[model samples]
Target: MTRSRKTTQPLVKICGLNTLTVVDAAVDAGADMIGFMFYARSRRAVTPDLAQALGEEVTGVTRVAIVVDATDAEIDAITATGVIDMIQVHGKEDPARVAELKARTGLPVMKALRVATKEDIREAEAFFGAADHLLFDAKAPKDMKGALPGGNGLTFDWTLLDGLKIDMPWMLSGGLTADNVAEAIRLTGAPGVDTSSGVEDKPGVKSPERIRAFLAAVKQTHLETAT
Candidate 1:
């Protein structure tokens, strides 16, 4: 389900990286950022020690720690590892909390907004100045089984973000893959793109081939668009 080779080369982020092998695959695939999940409820959850080790192996790629409404203690434990470059809040954190987490961890914050409607996009305004970056993701249906915060692999209407202006840097995520990512970028003009299950063989298992293909697809977009 991929598109013709196009190349916008939007800032690519590979999320839900757990093991060192997958980490290497993402890094080798030219990911701009690598995300490690810390939410205990998630199948992709990794311990702080593991994240630290994996983060150490990466040189150029930014390492991000993903949490869902985590307590100060939980966040402290993860940041204490010193491997994470950014903290991604995937929970219902208010702007004050976002600011507090940024100050406490001394790392830039990316707040995720689960969009089900246009109002959800509007909600992002609250985090404008509080967070360093914004991530727009699909909001899981209330009846969906075992739904986690951000990686449900559901796609919202890209047209919702078309011509929408916001202050902070942002990334387009949720159900993005090599197949449709080019169109997604074209529709939204996103500065960056993120993928979790889209590159995985299963919920937590990352396929190296898929990772390489996804990156190649993203890079192709930049090439096609530049010409």
Candidate 2:
């Protein structure tokens, strides 16, 4: 079942967080969610132990674990730490797998769809009943070098999501930074926004200043919209 919206404000998620400094930065900046990558291949990946330590620095923000095609054992290990509040599947997990993960972990599961075209957005329907939430991220081209499942810092045409309709809460991700997040949110009217590489100094190194700036921009947009 889809989770109900928690607040009226647009959610801000700072993803790919690995260090306590970045974790604290995100929480202090009023991010609604903070994501710790569990996919080993990604530079942002962190062990469950490290994630737990970093999570300790968080208080109110939801903590999310991002995994790509993890096995049952891996999932068990990650959940065992009791650090994650939500699970985000970023690989080729089908609707059934999404449901299975929720049943197995008893945590809300979010399915991420990497989109390059409108047809990709339509794929959200397949996960409707299973995933509690959805995340739409940019899909890197086939020939793009060193592109992991996400955090490529590549963006799709926002126009593709102009008339997007889905059953559950969703977030707009990919290539989002402080300078453009306001525009992205205005264009797509996304209930939430997520960033990984966008707030990074390099591929997995998060910039605390960028993180604060991004959150500030989102807050400004919300304030403007409310008036």
Candidate 3:
């Protein structure tokens, strides 16, 4: 299930990696993508120097830069580092901004939209041809105070995605782990899966063993589906 030459496999992404050891662990664990957070406010944020140091270790793995509602200057600065292969905008950027970034940076754009209601899910339809990848993570509840947009470790009801389909490739993130990843994929049939808080021992610390376990669970889910 890990290395499938036949069955179409899901890409596994390990986000919020800060240190070389953790980044190495993710790459060693066979993750398809490694994410580096640029939002300094988040506990998982890493300096550009740290990201470059860790990013240098990545060979076959795709390096992703995770940023918030970043301005064009910020995007320019991060993309200038020449380490990132993809840009993941985990913020309130609209479709126009996403398209602009894609035009300017020449990097594949991965837009993260927090879903709380069906309307929110439908809202991303406009970005279908505009974005390279679309991510659906749980939205910060309105009344809740100061919730980080992407890695809040919260999960929206999976049933919310029932029968949901989009022309764009998408992922199921938020509250995913080794324990429930199989169920999440079975429930939503996501083409890809991402994790940050789920594989962490704390806010930003990643566990290599956990990464392997989660990947195994996704494999298990695919097997169950193939039957």
Candidate 4:
């Protein structure tokens, strides 16, 4: 489980890592979780062979496999490698599918809830038992060009999470950066946070320095909140 916002640093998940160098940087800099993209449409997508190698190098942190509306065959291929520690469904998967994925993979599942309003937030309650964790992310506008399932780098109003009453571990995501993550955490009271484009030098290209900076910012927030 992730630490509560009032107790210690939020669990930082650096998403879309396509290389081992950035993975090393994030883990070494104290990231609690690291994400690998499996959705074929994503620029950061990696083959099962490569993911296995990278997952092998992962140590002392959760190794998450991020997928978007993946097929059972595709999921089977990913889990077959026996490297992924968790599954993050970031598409239009329903609660049943979420539960199925958990049973099929035998790994904890985190269902992504895209939020643009209160109704979106309310939808998360349905997945309470289906998912091990819930992730609240910004919903991309329909007019946005070339938008994939996630990693759009957009942020919703943080106050929308205020007074949320879900009864499971959850994470805040979307448009989170080293600059604004502390404020986002303060507003949402999330126990964990996720970042993709915010720390990237470009799409699918992670910057080592930015990874370190983002983790440092999260640590600073924990220190301030603890005091």
* lDDT of every model, 2 decimals: 0.89, 0.91, 0.85, 0.89
Give candidates' CA RMSD values in order. 4.7, 3.9, 3.2, 3.7
lDDT of 3 by residue, 105-201 (tens): 9999999989999888888887888999999999988888768988988898889898787877788899899898888888898999999999988
> What residue pairs clash in candidate 4, if any at all?
none
Whole-model alpha-carbon lDDT for candidate 4: 0.89
Q: Which lDDT value does model 2 have at 64?
A: 97
Pairs that collide, model 2: none
Q: What lDDT score is found at residue 202 in candidate 2?
A: 94
Model 1 alpha-carbon drift over 4 Å, by segment: 1-9
- Cα lDDT tens digits, model 2, 1-227, are 11122333799999999988888788877889999999988999999999988876666678899999999999999999887899999999999999999999999999999999999999999998899999999999999988899999998899999888876899999999999999999999999999999999999999999999999999999999889
Q: Name every residue pair that clashes in candidate 1.
A: 2-179, 6-220, 6-221, 7-220, 7-221, 7-222, 7-223, 7-224, 8-221, 8-222
**What is the Cα-based TM-score of model 2?**
0.96
| Candidate 4 lDDT over residue span 76-169, tens digit each | 9999988899999999999999989988888999999998999999999899899999999999999999887789899998888889887899
Q: List TM-score per model, in order.
A: 0.95, 0.96, 0.92, 0.95
Model 1: per-residue Cα lDDT over 1-227, one tens digit each: 11122223578999999988888888877888889999998989999998888887877678899999999999999999888999999998999999999899889999999998999999998887899999999999999999999888899998899669986789999999999999988889888999999999999999898999999998898778778
Error of 1 at 49 (Å): 1.1
Global Cα lDDT for candidate 1: 0.89
